[model samples]
Target: MKKTINSLKIPVVFLLLVSAFIACDKDYSVIESDVLGDENSDFTTGDSLWSVTAYNKKLDSLQINNLGTTSISATAGNLLGVFNDPSYGLTTASIVSQLVPSTFSPEFDENPVVDSVVLNIPYYNTVVSYDEDNNPEYRLDSLFGDNDTPIKLTIYRSNYFLRDFDPNNPENVSQKYYSNGSSTENSALNGTSVIKFDDHIDNISNPIYSNAAFKPSNLATITTVGDGDDEVATKSGPALRKLLDNDYWKSVIIDKEGDPVLSSQSNFKNYFRGLYFKAEANTNDGSMLLLNIAATAANITMYYTSGADGSRTQETYVMNFSGNILNTFVNDYSIPLYDGDKILGDNELHLKGTEGSMAVVEIFSGKVDCDGDGILDLDAIDCFKQNYRQLDDNGDYVKDPITNRYKLKKLINEAQLVLTELDNLPTGSVEDYHTYDRIYAYDIKGNSTTLDYSIDPTTNTSDPLNSKIISLGQRNDTGVFKIRLTQHLNNILFTDSIAENTPTTIGLVLSNNVNYTDNAEILDSGDTVTTVPRASILSPRGTIIYGSTQNTDPKKRLQLKIFSSEAKD
Candidate 1:
């Protein structure tokens, strides 16, 4: 077989062929050739006098399977919090991170004296407008709360220990914690959580009427923004600075009487454990802060006086939050993908991300019950079976009777899958504006199952490419993620009849969370387990899209374009 170059100039073979149907009125003049079989056909196996044809067509149906297994990521940015969205429902997000050693010296010298402890988090001003240069014109200095809807943010000691891999076997790199509650080492609130919500200047809600709403929290800031000579060299505006209990950390950092455990990062981690941030709405209604937990400026600062009263040398040991990969982020969406009151199956779908819902796609199988007749419709099944054939049922290659091969006037050089965006994104807030970068098709086949395939992200990172896995491109201007099903399509088109590859339906995932966690789900991608790493991008928001149920706009629906080579008739 001769190799061919696709539109991208990559040397590869396309294993996508389809049964012909005369539905659309394509230009009759463009029809250069066609393959027809009659009783006179006697073409054998090895024939060199044949022409190969290539063309394009769309899949008949794309069933969405609601694959609601474990959904979460390995790495992410921003510490999530509590908020009540009137339309979307309640959202609660939090941060679980490892704290490393701040100073290697392990000693507090110069007559150390306690000053204060604070947790600084920053957020953006709710969208006002932009200037000609695209800078935020008017900045409303506020955190995430408004209308004094009290939201109590609490800090607590993490109940679970975070490890890079399995703690039992240091050599085992597989067992690790994930965003979705799967791993055994998941951290929960087992200890007491101290409420850190007491920096209000004045509670004047008595004077202000209930009709008016105002922000009630610390600032999310940039440095250098204060009054006259009192202007400090350091900057602190637009930051959520919560005063942590001075006595608690003082016991751990200073009051320990020069504890040697605090000297080593590993010793301190085991002894002190870590911190967990939880947000409780208190009431069912409140605002949630969109925080950059991974911000270079975000931290927990411990201030101390290293010298005497008037001559004290003010020094600080900062607990950096975003540096370690051991950190785990979580987002809880209170709303279900389907209406709680209604009952629906996998065929009827819903897709969402972040603190939102999800839509699973069904694989191409199963029969239809259109006329309320439950029995599998024979005519419909026969039609589907015929349309999916690569060769005629009699075992003869589908080729021209005269030339002994198939050829065509046209071939599909490129095929792309496109999706439409729903206009239901939240307005005004910059944090809510961005969605996920890449969408993934997860393999759901487990062990004892013949469904074998591979999925590798061929973009963003430096991972090598595997031809067996179909990689979907990220969303473009048309609001759809164009995917390349070249490799997977080849398997379905050319495999032997006895051992046809089991095709797996894929779920749209925000992060590249393609881990073969379930023993049943295995990867025969032919590459090493080391090279096929599971990587993902963080998506803080969700969006609505046209599902297979929608019948309005032709472009908005889910579609698949197959580029195949045909035996010219």
Candidate 2:
């Protein structure tokens, strides 16, 4: 946004802006201009492309979770599917701020309006500086500090970027970079030149405490309070406000409607870091826990390399997590950071060339310590279990299995038995998984020369085909199951090799020829033994047959038949 005061060139010069609207004829639509200074036009008629109050109001509309509620719905199950029920934790406002869409318009323009814009969002920080002796001194009220506490310096790093899109190219649309390298000027739009916001502080009653003061480099400036604003101390604590001059905190002003004042050294377009809010030891308290919440925004900076065709393109790194800070601290407080004190979160941004041209990739690789307990969230076993469920094979809920490998293996073995039918077979019970009954036909063999089962038999009336019919009662349920004693083999007997011996137990002597005496007798001998297989009525249903290769004889085959009982109703 740029502004300049110049001499009036023409008395009747008419400034016209073409806007899209429905035509009165209904058949055609076109861009038409309404006179800017027309007498009948409403004062608020023109589009408000760049307005600060409206923008600030929009920022204020972002929500936060408060501790005051009695009962709450699970945020993960309710809001955005992020937090789960038992793990009802959220990020601090700083972390949540990252979720704010980079391309959103606050102004309610009926039609799309394009305008260069600027906005300033405030933040608090704990400033540390060096004294003349090279010893570390602390400032608590610079742009990063709190004034009401014993802190001396407070400061903030403001993020700046373009808000509107370029009408010329679609790919160069409303994408926000940073204001680190821009040559834009820093001034205020309204004449008041001052903006104040709330920054919380802790007194002596708080858990943490500190009192220090120091200065900063030219990157920021501080303003003093004047005699007229003595009433500002009403809330700033009795001795707290008097420790510094009137302009203890600097007021950052960026002139939007004028030429850019930021020099190229600033690199506004590439400044992708986050605003870290450091606290003085005096104001430390439990505020560090506040930073651990997921509501806090994890800052991300996207890097890109422009393509040779004068268009933009993404690189091979589809995306990555840069780093995340709890936005809060815990346990101890000092002017500077320590090695083990900082808790970093995964928050790399997604960078892509043309490969990611389709849809944005959702890469999750960040951690949040919403409670600020010094322990990483992932390492907290209870916290992890509360937030995530154990998924079964069907993607349904199930109890979390024991972590011991042996215990898990046993449980898996038991689970597989539920899918088998051995429990319902003969002499079978649920607990009888290890039991087996008497073995029958343990050493059975098939006919060596034929695929079908056949037995050698008597040469005369007792046919080999009839002797081969060894009935084994099989309960089959496929279609209709009926038992039939049939000749299983095609041949009756061979010519010269075999014959039947005289039978001993004679029942009836009947012959076709009266002169000849021929009768068949039941024979009970060591070589001939028989057992009639039993069969009971089986209500018809479906059946499944399992055919397996004989384990004893590799070439032998066996089949199992299963039947479904008919419903008793």
Candidate 3:
């Protein structure tokens, strides 16, 4: 055996040397290694699946005052009417706006007789076609709920004075008003008595105007001026044109022409206060309209004939809806309760517009075993330090001495927050009427856009509807929303203290326009949410989406998927 081993060693050595020469000479160009070597590899790419905690948060009240000199075009249209959503319940929208005389003082001719007073508020419409007589046909836009259904609309004289400056603040800060009429928080801040619904002038007994069944019409309004051959017909787009009681206008405006009440804008505002467009549900489901109350064409025109009997000429006195215009809302929906553990998130997210609910999304929530089952909850998976921390010889995370936290070093290529709509939503006439096409995401703590939104190159300033469309992947055909958070995620990962800035919760709500990023202050009991997206306040639609705690179908649950690469050690 010893001799055989010694003899075999020489043969084995000689054979290996011959085989090595043969292999070197043979063509092996097609053979490739699957593994990317450390020297050759710049980074190792993989997807980091992170759990998202999403839950519905109820909005108590939203700031609805269009403050200062802000034009109506710059903001969402004044919502007026009632909409009974099958999912969100009843929403009554009303407007209380100050009226300003076109001129401070008026010098009327002799025998000024008030004829007719008309209030004109234009509707958002598009010219569909024109008839042979050059009369245009219109289609109403921005109308929610059943357009055929009617809402009880009443226009009243508001007795409460909306101030320009806060009376309580010595610094002369602007006054802030909320959507709820019962909210006394703003009044408490200004040291003034709250203006309740019953405080309006002639609201019940003698409103300025009342419509038991008010439904919007898409037909153009045509009026004939003059008589016989001298008559000229003027046509305008669809509008809510109502003739007010002539005697009322005469007593309030025409009769007070030379009085001190009509001497200046401030004087007129104080004397008249404002007009309130109060909306109530005439039926279980009524119509809602986005009104252009501040449009140039929208005004109260008082037609009066002046001068002698022989030279009686029809003159006009115009009053504009100006100054502190406020939109009040009455939401009669059940508030979503957070009964489950917040760390595990909620089952469904309720996102409604106006004074409705919004979803709060937390990214990279730490591990939590809520059920005490010796296993981490799937919804509470921690993907922060566990994925990015450096491992030592014992495979334990290497911690920094100064911060006392695991060191994280990873390059985030892309991070997307995926939201899936609930597929089994109730399907019916009211339920399927209007579905929101877009949803906006913002930093709740900062009350501003994320870095990704700011850096998105597709932001079209000219067209707000198209702004950030790519980054904010709107609801696709499959009913899914994928919002890019690449820059936002990178910022958190690269921050000096990951634990301090790790959980950046985001707010998700339906937006009328994403480009309208201006935030309106929220009046609530706590200081948790100070403001919300103003675009959301303008919309009346709502939707339901899957949250994180839906365990049956994990794929439908909200998640943050990050395409990342490991940094060089």
Candidate 4:
């Protein structure tokens, strides 16, 4: 049963005072006690049994571009390669990035000749130990799936231009892109008729770079230059450093020096376009990597020599992966059917990342019977008002004469949403762990963080992973997630008017980092689900958990448990 609270008149001055008091940094336990009177002398604490409904919702398309009007790149890392999940099926990640020349249209020495072009994209790694010779041993981080298995990698010259502002919008809004390349809406937004991989300039017949079988290695790279006593060695962490064809760079860049196309950034971008890093599965199970492609170390260097053969000087030109960079995902997963009871909620909740799935949770839904007469008389909100509000001699609500609203008799101390994972499901293979460490909750309508999440005292601004871990809740050893909603619930129950302060639906999704609260636009949803969690776009993982309709074990069902305090009267 469910219920909603009706509009009740409340004192504006009193509500203002309570709002002001809640904004302070004092401890909630002492604050609530002082606001509602002494706990031992006048108040008693107890739990409110409220109904919660939760169901799985699939995400068709999610925004991938981090390009804003003021910010160049808001995302942390770009995902690459393919991974096959036991439950969520296959996912392929690719990158489309715009490149900028280190120096625009500069005069090269007379008769310049291309020597080699080297592309270096650094991997997330850490130095574990140092050898006797002072060489460091490194371990790769941010890699998922099977490291031993190889995946097909291809780099192509992109013909499609990634614009900074939307041409269709009059206000010059920043152009947005989604992860799903198959979406016709996204194709239309790009002003291109072709979809997916067809947007690239190169084909299978002739690509910039192609490797049918490619895998990442953890060993440090050692480059030696010169010979004999003059020889020197440089050791660096593991990275994707490969030499490209010199003929290709000579024809594309060297031959066009001082041309009108290379004069400025606007003209250069249209002439060169960019590079597309496409990933394909070579085997049934492949590897995925989180690449720091926007880092200063990630760039393409063109090594060349200028001047006469007898007096040649070595020169280097660099191109950086910058401007408008975005990630594209090709997901092959069985879309879960939504036939479950909406009021009671579904039996299973599916939570996945990277244009995957999310869950909608509604608390205190529908009407409920307050009295034990076996008849539905009032809704849950009305029941809360009747049971927790002050009563008169005739057992009716004691209304304020000035405001004509029933005053709140109980103060909400804490409200927590508990989600338990399904133990029987296979999370991942023995080689890799696919389950996420944290799940974020936000207001569905506002597409923003809850009051509790915003006011979490333990939030560490410097370290994203450590921020709000206790308040937002991490996946425990038993596979349970607990999220606090104290301030959010208090706002709803203690508000002066029900019309303005009704309970809102909550959204739960897997987060790569809790500190990232920014929302990314959805392509085809037409602003209905306006945005998705930005942190969720960085990960490629999934998990299954119990919803609100677990019949076999009622205790395992999703619940909104609220601890409140009321006057001893």
Candidate 5:
């Protein structure tokens, strides 16, 4: 038989062509579309479908999965591929002709992003109303005795039917009455809420005792007024407490103009959006990033926005009193083609500085103008440079020190006065400490000097002339001592008169006197032996020289005694 070389060659050639066709089909799977099947055709792979098409569907699903987990960079070209809605119905399937380069471009997510940065500032003053009868027809009062009538202020999603009031019959709107202890059934209410009560009834009563009655003056609107609701004019819906929780509020300088002046100093301000620190490497180079505080105040705001590549990119941030970012940025916090910088995480600004693990960010160069003129701001004063007190007398950052000193002095003086009064009380009085004469004297130098008048005058050597008591001697523990009067007493010895005709040093002579330990004795020119006092003369003198016995004897058995009424030491 002729060896069939042609037949063998043909078979081999056919096999080679088949193998090439299979290999080409595998490569085409990468770019294959779902167009081959009818709209109702199951996307699920089955043995019945062409192998190439089935293989392509499997590859397509893997690509979709990979895209979901990948995070794109801000500077990267938009690589999201295809605007086909994952939620599209079968009827909306793309036509074969619609496939083109422009149509294949990735769709950017344009959903409105809410700025998480939110602040809740309470209206300074609050209000509430009460009804006495608890019924539709009853007397109402704002002043409910000394007891504080408690009320809850609620924030709501909208102004959905709070309650309708019939002024003619207030009981019709009794549902809106502030919940008090007696009205337990009316407590539940729907709205974001806050609560406060006067420690005692605020006494909003008119003392005139009029017959007129007052109910809650309608539901007080949220406001910043000293005596109003907690609503801000710009904010709608029920007043909420959760929103007020992390808001940074500045002192209202000229409060007369309705709204409270918002905090302008970024150093004192905070954005409390939800976020925290975790150890991570940078996207570009995987370098270690140190998280640290850049300023005293929690001023940073996290700028979160969607990138063109369908991934979120966040810029670590801080802002001043005004919505100005501290660190460098291509522009202000305003999002390009978006509303007030779509904040993420619930319209609440997260305070990264307070959390302590926040990453430190450099202030943007555009925000740091150094000519003493402001940066990126029309006014020379930067947002961070606002004077809270608004006083720039010396142009120094610190408010004037003069007022502080005066304030300190006034406080000290008030404290001293209070302490002085306290000292005068029984618990702290001088008598308690045995310092009766707590006369504190001040001299030219404001130094203190003390005098203890509680002591006897004779023992006190603090200058009796400078002292108050005129007497030199006082009754001592021992018997009294007497000196005979003489002209010399007036000069140097003894005399009854303060002035003497002539000066003389009179000699000392002891006058007859009663001894504390013995019977009385008398001294006379003839009776040196004390004959006058010898029993007979001791008798009551019957002789009446004047109205009674003269008893010329210096002492004739009479004893001298003194009684002191002062409580004994």
Candidate 6:
């Protein structure tokens, strides 16, 4: 934000702001102060003059990983029958999860009777509203496909093991899959892969990750559970139920009684591997469903009668998916992006899905030469970084070097960040993410070796300072999310008592926050890592918003507005 002086005015009025800094409401007191009398008194009862500076810049793509969560989003935006997102294109996601071994081997009764071998995957439900019948309507959390709609889904045995991680590749050492542009040739993935990508045909050369023709499968039916006798009003929701193939289950688990692989977790993981759940739209114009395979009640139960012949009681061999970090189950998005013809010409930005473009916004993405170089290139130009001429109490420019820098001494009352969508955006049926309660400002600085700010290396999901993302809603006429960046901006503006400097660059994903936060998966160490999911469950359907780079209207572009006050020192 550039501040200009009024040169025309002869007698400049320098109003003295002398309010008690300790009194609450902070810097806002200046705007509503009603003190009269001496305009030059140092102890006047008035609000401080809180100045606002709007900083806007086009975001550059930064390297991010450890997002860990994969998403399955198939949407067709049809209000009538089945809804599909035709504008952005339809995409079905698949997942392959590694099963942690059973605690102990159980002996079956003589002539064991097989009742049923069923796989139950619970749907994501957050209790929100109730229906007319007083039936509890569940709000699906990580679900993005058409609600109350049907889509074809299948489960398969993965021929290849997920070579995403190993003991050689630790958490500190990030893998190539985490970053979009990391070195793939030397990705530390030792073993060969059996899963093939059929993207390139007879002539095409590039191997696509989304192509899943190489894997073998069995179909799983998606149906609503608790509809019949198992009706528990509170926990009633949809599920993907599949009867296990008798021969396959027996060979993998039942018949392998004395096998050493079944005795150990690591050996069994290498021998049998995991199951892949694949969802498909069938046609280009069908609906999609978002089912949470990592939910609490989702598992495969091997039903068998272990009781004596006359007694006959049922027993189960449960195959629970204990989300191991090394397993690396993820969503592979193969959807089309919002490629407006105009954007190609001007290189303009358009924020969309995970498969689409992401906006890289910064507090001050603009560059400046802090070392007094003739040209500006590296350092960011902002109120915190930029050096200015010292100002006196009379509001006149004072020649001082030591006290010239801006000091964030007072309490940071608040800072509002408003990101607006372009008027000439890609048109289509976009989910008001507010309704689904899915939008977040992710600190995507997972694999960055060098950043201007000091980020905690402990967790990659959230920044140490700013963790929660709360949407302020569409405040103005244009569709914009008014995000409160008080804590985020405060850290940037003020120097932490411990660390002398800030991060060089920080990443923020304006995507779904829940996908990165709400997780029911536990690691091998028995630690619950809910900070970030192994994959995102955000639907491929999305919205296109404008960046600060667009100059059509200054008021409609992305900008960071900081309202700060100076303490009465």
Clashes of 1: 32
Whole-model lDDT, candidate 3?
0.72
Q: How well is each residue in 1-569 modelled by candidate 3, as lDDT tens digits?
A: 24423433433343345334423431111111124454664345567567667877777556778822333343356888888766667778888899998887897788788888989989988788989987788988778878778888888888888898887788989888776623422121223444665565654688899889899999888776888999999888999998999988988887787899999988988999998888888777788888888787889999999998888999899999878887887766644433234667788888888878788887767665545588875444333544555567797766668856555555455578988888856534654343445789998877888777787656555445556764676576557888877767655544533345434788898876787788888764374467888888888888788888857378888888876555333
lDDT for each residue of candidate 6 in 1-569, tens digit (9 for 90 to 100): 01222211111122222222312221122232123334432222222211222221221111112223343222211011112443344444444456665554546656666666787765444556677977555544444544434544444565445433554555644322221211211111222222231211221232112222222112222343344787543334655555765555665676776677777666777776666444444444444333455555667877776566678776777777654322111223234333233221122334433323444444555554556666776645343433232345794444325744334233334345565555544333443433332234434333221121123112224321122223222224455665554555555544331133343222223344432432222112121111222222233445545554444356655556654333222
Candidate 4 lDDT, 101-196, residue by residue in tens: 888886778899887899998887878899999889997776778888899998988888888887887999877776653442223234322346
Report the error of model 1 at residue 62, Å: 27
What lDDT tens digits, residue by residue, belong to model 2 across residues 1-569? 01110111111122111101211121111121234343432221211010000000000001112111112111110011011001111111122111122222122212222221111221222336655865444432111112222322232332422223434456874322111101112111111121111122222232111225422222222322234855232111011111211111111112211223222212222232222233333333111111111222221212223334545443211111112221121111111111110122111111110000000111111243536687546423222222223335794434324532111000000000000112133211223311211010100011011111122121122211122112211122221111111111111111111122211111110011111111111112121211100000000001111112122221111111111111111
Better of 4 and 6 by TM-score: 4
Over 1-569, each residue of candidate 5 has an lDDT whose tens digit, in order, gives 11322323433343345334533331111111133333422221211100000000000000000011112111100010011111110000000000001111122233313233322211112223334733122221111111122122221111112222435453663212111111211121112231111111112231101111111222323423122474445322221112221112111111111222123222122211111111111111111111111212222232233445566653222332121111100111111111111111112111100000000001111232334555544221132223111223675333235533111000000000000111121212122221111111111111111111122122222221222221111111221211111111112111112233321111111111111001112212131121111111111101000000123222221111111011001
Output the worst ten-in-a-row residue range by lDDT, candidate 4. 1-10
TM-score, candidate number 3: 0.80
CA shift of 255, model 2, Å: 2.4
Q: Between candidates 1 and 4, which one is better according to lDDT?
A: 4
Model 6, backbone clash pairs (residues 3+ apart or across chains), number: 28
lDDT (C-alpha, whole model) for all candidates: 0.39, 0.18, 0.72, 0.72, 0.17, 0.39
Q: List the residue pairs that clash in candidate 4.
A: 2-366, 2-367, 3-366, 3-379, 3-380, 9-405
Report residue 503 deviation for candidate 4 (angstroms): 5.2
Model 2, residue 445: displacement in angstroms? 53
The weakest ten consecutive residues by lDDT in model 2 span 50-59
Whose TM-score is greatest here? 4
Q: Is candidate 1 or candidate 2 better by lDDT?
A: 1
Return the TM-score for candidate 5, rounded to 2 decimals. Answer: 0.12
**Cα miss at 185, model 1 (Å)?**
18
Q: Is candidate 4 or candidate 5 better by TM-score?
A: 4
Which residues of candidate 1, in runs, are more than 4 Å off?
1-75, 83-88, 121-150, 157-239, 243-248, 282-296, 307-312, 322-347, 354-357, 366-411, 414-503, 510-569
> How many clashes in each structure?
32, 79, 0, 6, 41, 28
